[model samples]
Target: MRGLKDKVAIITGGIGDLGYATAKRLFEEGCKVALFDLKQSDAGLAKAIDALYIQVDISNEEAVKLACERVENELGPAQVLVNTAATFIFKGVDATEEDWQKINSVNIVGTSFVTRYTVPQMIKKGGGSIINFSSVSGFVGQRNFATYNATKFAIRGLTKCWAYDLAEHGIRVNTLCPGYIYTSAFVNSCKVLNLDIEEENKRASEMHLLNRQGQPEEVAAAAAFLASDDSSFITGSDLLVDGGYLAK
Candidate 1:
């Protein structure tokens, strides 16, 4: 994990559950994290790490470009890029077009923007790693999550194609697909579905082969590997850190 030492990383959505955990892990590995999140995200993770953080929504292209410029000016070219910022939707076809556009913009389009801005820097720096945050829903399917599933699935497609495109530039592109994990989002989802929080937690645990819901740190560990030399030979692979959910 410490192989990430001396590297600079630009981690999107770097203040929330998964993002915060990843940032902590990267910091522990001796990497400097330039976090791009919303206005609130800066506050959420400020006390946790001493790093450069910018407030910008993922769906805004100009905002992201500005954020990248600032990141490059403030912290050197990013040697590692982790596109973890995403908006989750749990609605089915009944989901409104506006909502669909919003989620798709952030989860898919915004991911592209971050990649667009960061890749050149990686190339100039002699290549690097790009790890995307996809989900199990992309591999299989999930109910009442059509909008979300679309974006996650699109992320995998992006990963696959980018792996080949960036390979010549010496950049590795891979996707990290996680199953259901315990987070504020999950807790809110349980409430929205009218299920008892504790009950749903137990249910999620049983759904996984490990009989437990994964923590953010679990996925963060995988990100560390993909970002470091440990996974130098890994590209275009969907690494499932889902506690065996897909195995079942």
Candidate 2:
């Protein structure tokens, strides 16, 4: 809540369910928000939140570089970066080279590209917060999630290393690991798989101690705390927004 007003915050995958919720929260806290995604953002949604949107493929370093420059010139140097952009590729031991490339390009390399360009801007501001989105998968293994979970685990690794590397710059880095949330992604996956939505939801709910899935806003709230001065004393840590899913 404190030390967030007037600060510039950049959120990758900003149009996604979780990322959008975070942008809304940061905007409400008086941060000038910028949304970067692979596709064009809805004008109405951008206008509603009064945030800037740029279409970018984070895997392409050149594009990421340009977008970062544009954001700095327009919204000012970013003091906070939320790396929520990711590609989901669920595969097991049968995963091929292509599968590995697709997931790694966006989930790992792409995240690095975005951070590469954004870090200098943060330095200009004397320091900043970098929120890297990992997941419960990062902490544990899952069925048919080898490709995806590998990247999530790598995200946590990157956060820890970045925290150490960037600490002297006054920047803080941390991973935001969340449990299953009832998002459009969940519904769409159910539809695509022809699974009963209610049954699937219930199945996911039972995995958490709370007996329910988490919400985007709840995760957003945690992100805001990390972005705000309230988390000044925290860094190089994994903040779990899970519903005690890993407790068991």
Candidate 3:
């Protein structure tokens, strides 16, 4: 996309399937990329792509602040920030305090910390885009998804508020709400549970009007658009890369 060349972009959950895919796309568009994750990457994936990888626990404000500083010093100020790191804790009304803490720490507070630190870098660069990963669950309820869904919903709310607060600084904030995407984690979970992979996939496929899971690259494409000047006028919006899941 236009205006992405030589820009710096940071993606959280960088080693994950979707996050890595987005990093690759942005790199191909000529952007310097940084991957921030809680876990260390064993494969040297970021090095392979010539991107910077930082192990960071975004829930800790100080760690996030330092990490952002390092990125600025290394890759220059970030012009695009994608907050894809999240903790999935599925629970219902019976959720315990511990469950709430675990989910909120990473999904909500952690996201906030990263954004709080990165916004200044963006402002220094004159403008930027922030993509917060929400989910279809954020819009609709599902069984035993109260804890996770609550945080996702909060993400959308946060995006809108940030958009309003950052507009004057030329920052754009939006939520990326995706449906079930066929990812390595899905296949691995099926194996761990001894579930038939094809059968489980079929069950998930039925949830979307497309009759199949979305791909990581497809979502990455939308992310690139939001990060680029292509989405210059878009902000405080939910870009549904859900394959018509909510249309049904």
Candidate 4:
């Protein structure tokens, strides 16, 4: 919790469950918050938290650059950056080149573009924290998940490299890998695939030792720790908030 007060923080995909939770936590910890997404956030939510919302397509370098600049101008140089914007595409070896491109552009390249622009601001403020979201998929393969898993794995890889590259500048980079979190996205995906929500939920819940899926706020707590000085000694590591899912 230390080192979080008065810091400027940015959360990409801020309208999403996990991202929104993280933003709320950071804001509560006295950090000025900014949310970035491809679409505008609900006015009530943004106003409730007294945070700024910026519509941005992270895959577009120009859009990312402008958004970062705008944040700096409005909220001050960002000292914490959480990259949560991603595209999800579940496919196997049969995945088309287009599938790969669509997922990679957002999950990988988009993450990089946001980080690329935010680093300078962090450097200006004498260092910062960067939390990149990965998933249990990053550590293990799943059936029909080649497309999505690849990007998650790459996120961890990028986090490690960025940790080393930015350490001298006082920036710490780490990956937040969560297990199956009960989110709107999860239920919606089940609907899209014509799977029973209850059945799918049971399947996912059983995958973790806790016998339940995680909540967005639970994951948000981990992100807050990483964002604060409490995790100053940790970097280039994979922090699993997976409900002991990996223990098995």
Q: Which regions of candidate 3 are displaced past 4 Å? A: none
Question: Model 1 clash pairs?
Answer: none
CA RMSD for every model? Answer: 1.5, 0.6, 0.8, 0.9
Which candidate has the top score in lDDT?
Answer: 2
Name the runs in model 1 displaced over 4 angstroms. 42-44, 191-194
The candidate, 2 or 4, that scores higher on TM-score is 2
Q: Which ten residues in a row have the lowest lDDT in candidate 3?
A: 42-51
2 or 3, which is superior by lDDT?
2
Which TM-score value belongs to model 1?
Answer: 0.95
Lowest summed lDDT window (length 10), candidate 1:
39-48
Give me the overall lDDT of model 4: 0.95
lDDT of 1 by residue, 116-223 (tens): 999988989889999999988888778798888888999999999999999999999999998888999889878888989998899889989999899999999999
Q: How does each model score on TM-score? A: 0.95, 0.99, 0.98, 0.98
Write the residue-wise lDDT of candidate 4 on 60-160 in tens digits. 99999999999999999999999998888899999999998899999999999999999999999999999999999999989999999999999999999
Ranked candidates, highest TM-score first = 2, 3, 4, 1
lDDT of 4 at 211: 98
- What pairs collide in candidate 4? none
